[model samples]
Target: SLILTESRSYWLASLTFLLLFSLMSFRSNKRLILTSAFILLTAGAVISQVPVLKDRFHSITDTKNNGSNITRLMIWKSHIKAFTEDYTLTERIFGAGDNASKLAWRHFGRAFQEVTGKEEIPPPGELRKWFHGGETHNLYLKFLTKYGILGLLGYLFFWIYVIYRNLERRDSLFIKAFVAGYVGFLVASFFENNFTDAEVQFTLFFILGVNFALISETAVRQR
Candidate 1:
C-alpha cells in the first residue's frame, strides 16, 4: 500500500472480488452468501470505529484535519494554476513537455507558501533545515500538466478501449476479475500516483494480460 487511500481501495477491491468468487462458487446458496457478506461488513464497520482505527478511514473532504488529502488538493490546484496562469495558449494546448510534473511540484511548493502562508512553512532565511519531496499525486493531473488536454484525452481513450474490449467477454471469470482490479486502480489513482507505483502498475497490467489470455483461450475453444 503506497498510502491509506490506496490501501483502502485495494482492500475494498479484494473483498469485492472474494465475494464475487464466493457467489460464483455457491450458485445455489446466494441467500447464504448475501447474509454472510452483510454480517461481515457490519462487523468490519464496528471494528473500524474503535480508537485504534481512529484515522484509518479518513474523510475525503476533510479540510481541517492534518490528513494528506488537503495537501493533495493544494497540489492539484497549484498545478492547474501553474499551467493556466503561466503557460501560453500553445503551451496550454500542447504542454511544456518532459518532467513537467517535477516543475509543477516546484510550483506547488510556492503555491503552498502563498496559500497556507509563512506560518505553515518556515520563513525565508530561517535557520532550520527542511526535507521536502513533491508529486502531483493525481495521475490525471500529472498527465494533463505534462502533456496537456490532448494527451489526457488520448490516454483515457486507450484506457477505455482496453477495458471495453475486455468487457465484451462478460461471461469470462478472469475478465470479471480484471474489471474489478481495473476499477480499483481507477479509484485509487484519484488519491495517489498509482500509475507511477511499481507494485500497482505491475498488478494492473498483470490482470489485464490475464484477461487477454482468458479471452484468447475462450476464442480457441469456440473455434
Candidate 2:
C-alpha cells in the first residue's frame, strides 16, 4: 500500500513548466518563455480570484467553512494593534516562543474590547485566534515571534546564498527558475504562513535542498 499519492498532478505540472520558463528567461532573451510564464501566472491568479474557483479550491482543502472576510479583516486590525504593543527590541531579537499567542490574545482582547465597546463578547474561536491557527498567518511575523532577529538573519542569508549562486551561473536555467519561484514564495509568505505547515515546509526544504545539491554537483563536474 502506497502511503502517499500525488494529488493535483495538473496543477503541479503547470507549476513545473512555469518554474522552468521563469528560469530560462534569466539566461536567454526568449520572449516566448517570458510570455508563457506570464500567461500561466495570470491564469492562476485569475482563477484564484473567481468566487467559484476560490470556493472549489477551498473545498478541496477542507477550508470551505473558514471565517468570513469581515471577520478576518477585524482580526487583522486587532492584530496590528497587538503587534505594535509587543514590538520591542527584546521581542524582535529573542522572540516570544510558544507563548506568543497568549500574549497576543491578551493584547488583542483589550484592543478588541476597547474598539467595539462590547463587555461580554467572547474572544474569537480557534479559527479566529492567531496562535491557535498555528501562527499569525504571516511568515515574517511568525519568524520574528518564534525565531527572533537572529533566526531571521540566518534565513535571509540562505536566500542570499541561493540568489548569489544562481547569478554566478551563466547558463543555468534551473538555477534561474528556482530563484524566481523562491521569490514568488517569499512574496506570498508575507500574507500567509506558507512555511508553517508541515507539508509546505517539507516541500520547500526539499526543493531548496535539491537546488543546492544540483548546484554543488555542477560545480564538482566543472572541477
Can you give the TM-score per candidate against the true fold?
0.72, 0.65
| Weakest 10 consecutive residues of candidate 2 by summed lDDT | 1-10
Q: Model 2 off-target regions past 4 Å?
A: 1-38, 41-51, 54-80, 87-89, 109-134
lDDT of every predicted structure (CA atoms) = 0.63, 0.61
What candidate 1 gets wrong by more than 4 Å, as runs, is: 1-43, 46-50, 98-132
Best by lDDT: 1
Cα error of candidate 1 at position 67, Å: 3.2
Name the lDDT value of residue 79 in candidate 1: 79
lDDT digits (tens) for residues 1-223 of candidate 2 = 0102222323444455566555557457577576876777776676677776555445434422433332333445555555567657776677767766656666555544554555655646732443344346567777766677787787778778877887776367677777667766666565567777999999988997898898888888889
Question: Number of the top candidate by TM-score?
Answer: 1
**Candidate 1 on 175-202: residue-level lDDT in tens?**
6556656666666566667787799678
In candidate 1, how many Å is residue 200 off?
Answer: 3.1
Clashes of 1: 0
| Candidate 1 similarity to native, TM-score | 0.72
lDDT of 1 at 186: 64
